[model samples]
Target: MPLTARNPNESENEQDASQSGDEKPVLIEIDHVAIAVNDLGEAIDSYRESFGAVVDHREVVDSDGVEEALLKVAESYVQLMAPTRDDSPVAKYLAKKGEGLHHIGYRVADCDEALERLKSLGHKVIDEHPRPGSRGTTVAFVHPKAIHGTLIELVQE
Candidate 1:
């Protein structure tokens, strides 16, 4: 499915007509909401105690230098991440923003296609190509400046 360039002046019906019947939607769903924390274990424990949430998956991504705990929430996840190294992006985020929401992961049919579509629309992207993400997913990061200050991760599982 191809991503349609949206025209602000077009009506809802006109926009709908632009999409072909056999084409898949560009965005599938909200994959997860990532939170950067000071301690992964502490954050996991807190979620378990407060909301009865259990960690569904945990992994230390050496490439990103961060450990993450995924708590299943419906078809989505509440991802809690902590840095494994001082120079990691998560570590820098923690040093600057303390503990809070980091980025949002959006499930897409194809990371490459989504990236191309975003680029064609003149949106700024952090990753020029998709890379391996946690849980064997293909992902790419879109710059926050292009999405109203909210960092977006396009995830293809």
Candidate 2:
């Protein structure tokens, strides 16, 4: 049976997946997996030489004070990012955690609605609302405290 067409007790958000065949708020494709690196160039070259992952997109996001290179991986992307300034959050993250996995971006149909749902669920959020992201996408960040140590970026393209 279709998920929403069933008679199970659920809030609107719970049944939203079936309403539009959208899977679930958190059930979208892994849009990208971001990693923090000291040298964005080196990381990009390594991915290209070692894994043959070519750069699909590269942009310096001034708002975030970071430069990122998106490497196409099937339908997803391996986002290699580096801070452009010492005050950047990525720099802070690297200082605290060193170079490694930074955050996971989960593609969402509606970034605003998904963020509202997360708020309603009492999750801590970094972005109070959707903001412009690289590659012409809208995105928001859910604080890592909300889901253990895993920082989440909800992306809507």
Each prediction's number of clashing residue pairs: 0, 0
lDDT of 2 by residue, 53-124 (tens): 999999999999999999989899999999999999999999998999999999998999999988987889
Model 1 whole-model lDDT (C-alpha atoms): 0.92
Each model's C-alpha lDDT? 0.92, 0.91
Worst 10 residues of 2 by lDDT: 1-10
lDDT of 2 at 33: 97
Clash pairs for candidate 1: none
The lDDT leader among the candidates is 1
How do all models score by TM-score?
0.87, 0.84
Instruction: Give the candidate number with the greatest TM-score.
Output: 1
Q: Name the regions of candidate 2 deviating beyond 4 angstroms.
A: 1-25
Give the least accurate 10-residue stretch of model 1, judged by summed lDDT.
13-22
Q: What is the per-residue lDDT of model 1 for residues 23-114, given as tens digits with 9 covering 90 to 100?
A: 55777899999999999999999999999999999999999999999999999999999999999999999999899999999999899999
